[model samples]
Target: MSKRKIHATDIFNLISLTDPQWDKHSRKFAFVQTTMHEEDNEYRSAVYIGDLEGKTIPFTTGKGRATSPRWSPDGSKLAFVSNRNEKSQIYVMPANGGEAEQVTFCKNGARGPVWSPCGTKILFSTSVEGVQDLQQDEEEKKKKKHPEPLVVEKMRYKSDAKGFLDEKNDHLALLDLKTKEISLLTDGDRDYGTPAWSPDGKSIAFVTNLEENPDVSLVSDVYVMDLETKEKKKITNSNGFYSALTFSPDGQYLGFLGHEKEFQSATLSRVWVTKLESGETHCLSENLDVEIGDVAIGDFHSGNVNPGLMWTEDSEGFYFLMSDQGGTGIYFGSLDGAMYPIHLPDEHVYAVSMLTGTHEAIVGVSNSTDPGELYHFDLKSQTRNQLTNVNESWKNEVELCKAEPIQFKAKDGWELHGWIMKPAGFEEGKKYPTILEVHGGPHAMYANTYFHEFQTLTAQGFVVLFTNPRGSHGYGQHFVDAVRGDYGGKDYLDVMSAMDYALESFDFIDENKLGITGGSYGGFMTNWVVGHTNRFKAAVTQRSISNWLSFYGVSDIGYYFSEWEVQGNMEDKVEKLWEHSPIKYVSNIQTPLLILHGEKDYRCPVEQAEQLFIALKKQGKTTKLVRFPEANHELSRSGDLALRIHRLNHVKNWFVEYLQKA
Candidate 1:
């Protein structure tokens, strides 16, 4: 009898993947429960709400992928978005789980439903039929002899996905509860999203990226609008990217997240608070090295532009999350700006929503060892109570590795921070092959978080080392800003130092054999590392920047990011960009390099991989390029589940084929 080949589906089932949500009152919780079938294509899921007894009762599930569950103001109902009818639409259900009623019967779609404070209106942004309208309006204007809009030719006039988009815009809309009247908030050729409400329900706060010249140097600024008067006001004026806006409980102060034009990595977002009355602003978390990643930001590094900062009903202090010490955790910062930890310092906490009439917050807690779980943490008593157990069955079956935080001195004597994952079934004396994994943002950090890739690598008998180099976030602003115009310089040294430390400290790590891999910025680094040194036997670069010159013209934010990082525009510094291009050094690369890219990725398009591959192949260096069909830059994150598994498997195979004993 032949043994059945273990597939990614098998591994996925062996591990748990749950996305949980907390209610406004924290009395009930809703999360997606996934059950994979071994033989069938269909996957089953349910939206469940847990009661005080820790028992989760099923709420609704008939057809679609239901998620983003938000409780109504009174907690009598739950509003969620589902793709049941082949498209995503808002749906409401009773808290106890019964019949679900559909809302928002629109032609295009609806998403991100948030109920009003009075429980009367639900606010969400929908893509209107504006393109046709804009074209018609342009025709009418042309008939009336109006001037034509400027036709400035750019490299991205035709994108990889949109394919020749002359006019592009995203608007905001609101749905009235009783009348069911939909009102368009702002009509313009720009992108506006992340709508938030004020405490008194008098106004709405949102972020808008005004399309200036199509250079992708978008101005994402915070704006405010009076709900009754329809008066709009731009609150932030600096040349910085501002997002994640929220109002204080008393409605006197507004908080937002922003980063200057120089630091465009999305990994150095700093918290800014503005007094609504005086219009004066102060940087609250300026010194902390953290990136605010969001779904709107597309799961990059959404720190809390507006973290769980529920102001005390009295508005004395606000809650926020700081990801500095090790992991992302919720903390309480006073109105005077003094900050302190709310939960125990040992655990990593996030997604904190306040429970009314209590000194506690319902937060999401996980650790280097455990997957995420909702915990009710009391600031007054300093006690944590677990609320939901989404993955009870996989609790013991899961192989959670210990992330031993390590600090080493760079060759320049600057101290650097990193974390190492020992091989699964690790013994202090046994030798194991190692994989040096680098994070993408170059601005991002590999903190003490539970990552599937790290754990799976450990499970396969590999020690993994990931570090926060000089360019990585969660240090200080200076450390993050230090990477500007210094790519492949000191930051590279920081990573090299981390690997050196890992090789020396871990007796179980085999120094003779090693593998290297990274995505995006990490990918660029991997390409650079392989070209610069032959220490690693194998390397995989995912969604990376190879030729900086091509990337400047090809990527969505390439024009802006190149200017920000390289500190030079495309026209001004062609030689400098080429010098920073990883492909330039491919002649020296001897390691077996595997390049993974997405076909429709506009951010770091397939051309990047092509440039590196052609360079290496011409030089007789071993190389392979795997392109995922119909995938975007976020292949590892929001790509199809099966595709993500395929990507991981391919990476594992590439590494094992080159590094593992033959």
Candidate 2:
């Protein structure tokens, strides 16, 4: 660890290795554990059991990664995936933990290993195998493939880098452990993802996007195939994306995540269970309105995503987490659609997944003053048992800030949730300048988890206040939908209301010195807030959206997202897009502004920053532009350590210069 102060940014490859598959039945016991070591950019495997504790397994090669270690039903072998050879391929190892054997040899790569009920076959996905099989003998057969004299195309989707494009798709496949035969499961002009095996092992259920006009990024419906006859059938027929599937012990009903294409003008996802035989589906949870907060969900959440369904063994119901009570606590919900809070005994939980054969769950936790710790949560006793203490090195070297939960009523007579962190060296009765930090994703929420940027701001002698406004997740669906097609409207009022409530209730905040900053949606709000009011002495917008029109064509997901966000596309609602754009109201901005952007960002694109920089410069307004090379939209959350530090330092320097009292 470097001398730099520990913040969330300093941590690398933070992940959970819950209930690693153990082969204790064998004399030479072996278990697989997952770890995030910077030495390897991605997660790698380590075998632990008996004397060979926490040893890196050599079954994988290169810097590419492997994870989600699972044992065959009988514990005779281990199955996992590795990208060491440039493509993720399945590999199996003996329970004694000797040399591993390569099991999958598909050209497109295999993923999501599910052992057959009897452990004789493994099901996975192969990218080009499906499409290749369907292209006909002359078209797909490399030897017989015909070449067409195609004309050169004009420049399209070209920018600073990644000049052109090509056709890409992924499909599902299955492998026979006995004969080592690989068979294509789903084929044709679409993509298939997230394959899960039924409990009986007679059928394999996988999701596929089979629509002729398919949205490339959207998910697919659940489809099943008979193992004996190779006969296939569709389980659910719905337009929305469906994934992250699991068999509810009995296999009578299949649980999966159902994502609506459009909800409040944004992607709406939740847990749903589809009865296999009846073809009936039921929404598992109330809309909750907030996006899933657990870290294990990655970009997908709901049914069996992360902290995957901790079955009760009786199969009455399984437990999964959702963003609730303003994204602060992880609550447990069941298929019955009832929810209850799981107290981690003062620990801030980011993820909760069950360890197989254990009543206790492996949880990812971190608090305002504590680095992340993986602990075990006992269900029956409601007691949390401490597991691995990984952040020991920083116990003495880092300064951690404690966040105090604060709640105040917004002007609309409804209670709003927020948290405040005092400066590290705070002096009693002394007023300090404050920074009102806003979270982006107007649809996203700021949870009570560990945040380095907020802690760093407090260390720099600034009080930090952040909250979940109307459109933030963790709140119910109504609260999340409150900001639909209404940018800078009620959401802006809610933020200002939070600041007003803070000033009136907290006497330690300096009234004359206030600063604000955020990235993405937060950036959009920062731009909108400063333009709408000069209350903030300084403002910084990172990877923000200033002009809506320019963003529609430039950003990668702009076309679909803009239409969803603004409720209309450029072709249909030009006036509404411009009306809500921050740049349109630039003349009203008086506060000094700092614009930060990443060069290779395709989500928000660098040109969005360029437009703001040029417009502000033309107006001779106090402004500065900072760009990160080779960085993308997630520069702050998942960017390189050096770049993340520089970004943090830049924000602190900008605020200190403008808000610090002389």
The candidate that wins on lDDT is: 1
The lDDT, on a scale of 0 to 1, for candidate 2 is: 0.68
| Candidate 2 TM-score, C-alpha based | 0.84
TM-score of every model versus the real structure:
0.89, 0.84
lDDT for 160 (candidate 2)? 28
Q: Find the 10 residues in a row with the least total lDDT in model 2.
A: 295-304
Per-model C-alpha lDDT, please?
0.71, 0.68
- Candidate 2's C-alpha runs over 4 A off are 1-9, 12-64, 105-109, 129-165, 216-219, 228-232, 259-268, 287-308, 327-348, 355-358
Candidate 2 at residue 217, lDDT? 42
Colliding pairs, model 1: 289-474, 292-301, 292-302, 292-303, 293-301, 293-302, 293-303, 294-302
Clash totals for all candidate models: 8, 5
